[model samples]
Target: MASVTLTLLPGPDLLFVITQSVSQGKRDGIAVSLGLCSGLIVHTFAAAVGISALLYHSAVAFQLLKYAGAAYLLYLAWMSLKETGRSGLSATEPKRSFFSLYKRGILMNVLNPKVSIFFLAFLPQFISPAVGKIPLQMITLGGLFFVQALLIFSLVSVFSGMAGEKLLKKSMGSKSISYVKAAVYALLGVRLALLEK
Candidate 1:
C-alpha cells in the first residue's frame, strides 16, 4: 500500500513521465519509465551496500549531483523549445528514438540524489534483523516497489498518450501542446534549481 501511494504521488519522476507521454507517445513514456525504474535498481543496490550513505553524508557529492540534475532539466527545456520551433504546424511534436528517451530517463533519475537518499532512508523501515541477510531483503522489497511504480506509470502513460494523440491531430493544437511542454520542462528545471543541497 505504501509502495502504491508513493508511486502515485506527484513528484519529479511522475511529472517527467507524464510530460513524455503527453509530448511524445505511450511507447516513449513506458520506455522512459523502465529506464527510471532501472535507476531505482541501482539505488537499491547502493543502499543495500551503503554507498548511498556515502553520498548522503558527503556535501560535495550531493551538491554536484543536484547541480547536474538541474542542468539536465534545463537542457531538456531548451530541447523542447527548439522542437517547438521545428514542429510548427506539424501534427506530431517531434521524433526521438526509444533508446534516447530511455537513456535520458536513466540519467535524470540516477543524477537525482534525493532518490538515493529516499532509498537509504525508506527501505530500512521494512527490514528486520529477523530477515537474516539484510541486503537480500532490501533488494526484494525494492523490486516490489518498482513493480508498483511500473504499473502506475504505465497507466499514466496510456491516458496521457491518448490525450497527446488527440491534441496533436490539429495544427494549432500541436503548436499549443509544444509550448505547454516547453513551459512544463522549464518549470521543472526551476524547481530543481531551487532545491537546497
Candidate 2:
C-alpha cells in the first residue's frame, strides 16, 4: 500500500512519464517507464550491497549527482523550448526514436542520488535479521517495488496518451504543447537543483 501510494505521487518520474505520454504518445511513455524501472535495478543492487549508504554519507557525491541531474533536466527544457517554433506534428515532423527516450529515462533516474538514498532508507524497514541473507531480502523487496511502479506508470501512460491524441485531433497547436513541456522540465530542473542532502 505504501509503495502504491508513493508510486502514485506526483514526483519527477511520474511527471516525466506523463509529459512524454501527452506530447509523444503511449509507446514512448512505456519505453521511458521501462527504462526508469530498469535503472531501479541498479539502485536495488546498490542498496543490497550497502553502496547506497556510501552515497547517503558522502555529501560531495550526493551533490555532484544532484547537480548532474539538474543540468540534464535543464538541457531537456532547452531542447523542448527550441522545438516550440516547429509546426504541430505535421507529416514533416520527425518522430523521436524510442531508444532515445528510453535512454533519457534511464539517465534521468540513475542520476538522481536521492533515489539511492531513498532505497537505502526505505528497504531496510521491512527487513528482518532472522531472515538471514539480508541482501537477498532487499532484492526481493526491491523487485516488488519495481513491479508495482511499472504497472502504475504504464497505466498513467495509457490514459495520458489517449488524452493527448484527443487534444491533438482537436487542433491544439504544437507550440503550445512544447511550451508546456518546456515549463515542466524547467520547473523540475530548478526543484532538483535546489534539493538538499
Candidate 3:
C-alpha cells in the first residue's frame, strides 16, 4: 500500500537491515536498531522544521554530511566483513546502559543520511499547503510517522527479544548469528551512504 511504502521510503533493503538484525535477540543489536528508529523521530522533526530547506538549497553541506556518513558505514561494514561474521562477544552481554542505548538510537537516526533525506522528501505528499498552517501540518505528519515507526520498530524489538531468547536457549551456535546481525547493520549503513543527493 501507499502508506506502507511511504513509511519505509528507503525500501525493502532497509527493512532487511531491521529484519536480519531482529532475527535473533542480541540485546545490543535490538538496542541499536531501536536507537536507529528513535533517531528517525528526531530527523523527522528536524526535517519538518528546517533541515529539509538546507538540504534542498545547500549542495555542499549535503555532500559533506553524506560522505561523512558513508565513510562511517563503510568502516562498520569492513569491521563486520573482517571477521567473516564471527565475533567473540557474540554470546556475551556487554554492560550497556538503557539510557545510553536510547541515546544511541537517537544518534543513529540523526546521523543516518537516508533518514534525513527521506523525511525531507516523503512526508510532504499528504500535506496541503493551501489549507493553512504548514508548520503545524508538518508536525502532525511527522508525529504520525513517528507513531508508525514506533509501532513497527517496537514490534521488531519484541521479536528480537523473543527470537534471540528462543535461539539462545537452543545451542551455542546462536552466537554467530550476532555477527551476521552486525554485518547487516554495516551493510545497511554503506548502502545508505551511497545514495545520490
Candidate 4:
C-alpha cells in the first residue's frame, strides 16, 4: 500500500467566533460563547473520529461542503446587512432556551462545513501517523484548540456584550457598535466566499 500522510491542522479561527459573541448582550454573552465553544469541542472530536476525516479525504465531499459553507456565509452576510442596532439592541432578551442555545452552537459549527474541512487539512500537519499515535495527537490538538477558542470567545462575549449594552443605551454608541459588527460580519462573509476547498 502507498504511504499515507498526516499532519496537524491550524486549528479553529477564533476571529469570527469572537466577533459573533461580541454583538450579544453582556449577561448572556459569555454563556452563549461557552455554549458555542462546547459545540466546538464536540466537533473537534467528531472530526478527529471519523465523519470530518472521511469528508476531508474525498474531493467530492469537500467541494460539497465548501459550497454549503459559502452559502451559509452569504446568508449570515445578508442577516448582518439587515440587522442594525435599532432592532438588535431593543429591550427584549433572546427567547432561546439553554437547550436551544446548545443546539444552535452544535448546528452552527457542524453545518459550517469549512470548520470540519479545516480540521482535516490542519490537524494532519502536527500528526505523525508513522509514529503510531495519530488519534492521540488529533485529540490533543483538538483539545488545545477547544481551550483557546473557549478563552477567546468568552472574553469577546463578556467584554463586547457588557460594553455593548452600555453603549446600546446611547444612540451614538449603539450605532457605532452595530456599524462595526455589520462590517465585520460582511467582511467575514466575503472572505468565506473567496475560500477554496
Candidate 5:
C-alpha cells in the first residue's frame, strides 16, 4: 500500500511519464517507465550493499549527482523548447526511438541521488535480522516496489495518452504540447536543483 501510494504521488518520474504520453504516445511513455524502474534495480542494490550510505555521507558526491540531474533536466527542457519552433504539426515531428526514451528515463532516475538515499532509508524498515538474509529481503521488497511502480506508471501512460489523443484531435497543436513539455521539464529541473540531501 505504501509503495502504491508513493508511486502515485506527484514526482519527477510521474511528471516525465505523463508529459511523454501526452506529447508522444503510450508506448514511449511505457518505455520511459521501464527505464526508470530499471534504475531502481541499481538503487536497490546500492542500498542493500551499503553504497547508498556512502553516498549519503559524502556531501560532494551527493551534490555532484544532484547538479548533474538538474543539468540534464534543464537540457531536456531546452530541447523541448527548441521543438516549439518547428512546424506546428505533430505529423512533421520525427519519432523518437523506444531505446532513446528508455535511456532518457534511466538517466533521469539514476542521476537523482535522493532516490538511492530514499531506498537506503525506506527499505530497512521492513527488514528483520531474523530473515534468511538481509540483502535478499531488501531485493524482494525492491522487486515488489518496482512491479507496483511499473503498473501505476503504465496506467498513467495509457490514460494520459488517450486524453492527449483526444486533445490533439480537438485542436491542441504540437507547439502547445511542446510548451507544456518544456514547462514540465523546467519545473522538474528547478525542483531538482533546489533539492537538499
Candidate 6:
C-alpha cells in the first residue's frame, strides 16, 4: 500500500504516462503503462535474484545506466520536437504507432538505474529471512506493487486521455502540447543526469 501510494505520487513514471495519455489517447496510454509495468516486473525479478544488488553496489554500472537513461530521454525530446508540426497534437489519434509507444515506455523505465536500486533497497525491507525463502517473498511483495501500479496507471491513462480529447476538440493549445512534452522530456533527462550513484 505504501509502495502504491508512492507510485501514485507525481513522479517521472506518472508524468510520462500522463504525457503519453494526453497526446496518444487512452489505448496507447494503457499500452505504455503496461510496458512500464513490465519493466517493473523485470526489476522485481532482478531484486529477488540479487541482480539489483549488483547494480546498487557497482558504481560503474550505475553511472552507465544513469547516463544511458538520460540520453534516451534527450533523444525522445528531440524526436518530439522534431515532429512537432506533423504530430497533429490536436488530432484525435496519435501519429506514432502503439508498438512504438509501448517500446518507448519499456526503454524509459528499463534504462533508469534508480528504479533497480529502489527495488533492491525497498523490497528487502519487507522481506524476512524467517520466511521459507527470501526470493519468493520478495517476488510476492513485488508482484503486489506491480498490480497496484497497473491499476493506478490505468486510471491515470483514462482520465488524461479524456482531458486530451477535450483539448484536441477545442483545438486550443495543441501546438503547446508538443512543446510542453518536449520540455518535460528534456527536463527529466537533466534530472537523471544529475543523479549520483
lDDT string, candidate 3, 1-197, tens digits: 45455655655334543543444344544566566666766777777788766775777777776777656555654554454333333544344466665564555556555667777777787789898777678778777766666566666666656665566464554545556655666666666667676
RMSD of 4: 6.2
lDDT of 5 by residue, 1-197 (tens): 98998999999999999998887778888999999998999899999999999999999999999999999999999999998765333677788889999999999999999999999999999999886799999999999999999999999999988877766664546678889999999999999889998
- Per-model lDDT: 0.84, 0.88, 0.60, 0.60, 0.90, 0.85
lDDT of 1 at 164: 85
The global Cα lDDT (0 to 1) of model 1 is 0.84
Select the stronger candidate by lDDT from 2 and 4. 2
Candidate 5 regions with alpha-carbon error over 4 angstroms: 86-89
Q: For model 6, how does the per-residue alpha-carbon lDDT over 104-193 read when each residue is reduced to its tens digit?
A: 888999999999988888888887797779999988998999899989999999999898777666544456667877899999999999
**What is the TM-score of each predicted model, taking all chains together?**
0.93, 0.95, 0.74, 0.69, 0.95, 0.93
Better of 1 and 4 by TM-score: 1
lDDT per residue as tens, model 2, 1-197:
88899889899999999988877778888999988988888899999998999999898888999999999999999998887777435577788788988899899999989899899989999999898889999999999999999999999999988877776665545677778888999999999999987
lDDT of 5 at 89: 32
Error at 155, model 2, angstroms: 0.8
- Could you report the Cα RMSD, in angstroms, for every candidate shown? 1.9, 1.3, 3.8, 6.2, 1.4, 1.8
Off by over 4 Å in 4: 1-13, 85-87, 93-98, 121-133
* Per-residue lDDT of candidate 1, residues 61-134 (tens digit): 88898889889988888877777655433455356678888899898899888899999999999999796899
- Name the lDDT of candidate 3: 0.60
Q: State candidate 2's TM-score.
A: 0.95
Better of 5 and 6 by TM-score: 5
